[model samples]
Target: MNEQQNKKKWLRILGNIFFYGALLLLLFNPTAKGWFLRQLMEVGLFRPQIEQEAAMPKQPAVATAFAFRDATGTMRTTADLKGKVVFINFWATWCPPCIAEMPSLNDLYQQFRDDDRLVFLFINEDADVQKAKAFLQKKSYSLPLMTNTGQVPAQIFSGTLPTTLILDKDGNVVFRHEGLAKYNSASFVKQLKSLL
Candidate 1:
């Protein structure tokens, strides 16, 4: 009877240690937090709030032009992508929310990467662009990284960590979502297809 009580006490102690260790990892480790958030997305918790067709802009409202440089050091502007549906996401290396949504973005990108009608600009807000690139490489994500070259218009970007903007073929902001969202949903794919 005494041995059974001792075993029970050890089991409780081990359980407490495991629980606390996981809690600490979630709180302090961005990767762990991102993984946890991604699990929430897998359960459809962070679904994007895309507007319906009626709510979409009847007349294409001209979106603000922003300049950025791609990983290849090629300078590009929003104006340059006027005839294509442009998908832009502003994210940083240190942001857990950005990390959480990256896998979904990658999935979405993979679906449309070879399409000439759409352009995806994953603008990294990290101070060290190399770190952002390294993170993407480590995660085996094929997202094209771009860095801000000049002041991004407030209308286009409000300095949000995980802000996403979708521009129609005419360079109009058709959809804008701020915060982590699962972008690989069938509804979102259909909306993008409709725009194309």
Candidate 2:
């Protein structure tokens, strides 16, 4: 082949390799997926827009009964989190959207980790706790990780990955969002401050 033709062929091969490599990374690596999502957020995608309830009810319609075990194997429940702003996020390792939004969730967690009036629960829906822990540790996220030890409340998790529910101090569902969102947005922090 001529010199120019050989250069063109090599370029095409390198392009293909890069494309496939990125595809595999997005598919298999949770940290890569989270980084990609954060990039998208930088360009205005998945901007956090919290849907506030028109009238904050005294209690949630669905019972908030739930029990989950933390990384230290300590059992906890929403009932135990009464009188505090509880943020519950249901996610799984294989879920692309869940992985994508995790970094923003981590940022949100960092902002409130020191607050005694707020509690954040990152509930891993995957049955394998070790795999979930590995994912979090690999990403170096400090968010509180938990796995459901008992039946998850239907109101909290309706078989959806990346479902988030914010409960008020009285344990009423004040905001609920399904799918991916930028949890570190200013509006979201303002909403949480309002509750606080």
Candidate 2 lDDT over 83-188, as tens digits, reads 8988889999888788888888899998889999999989998888888888889989887888877587776778888898888777788777788888888887
The model with the greatest lDDT is 1
Specify the highest-TM-score model's number. 1
Summarize candidate 1's per-residue lDDT along 1-196 as a digit string, tens digits.
6999999999999999999999999999999999999999999897875565336653344446889999899998988898998999999989999999999999999999999999999999989998998999999999999999857888788888899988887887878878899999998888788888
lDDT of each: 0.88, 0.82
Per-model TM-score versus the true fold: 0.91, 0.82
Candidate 2: lDDT of 156? 70
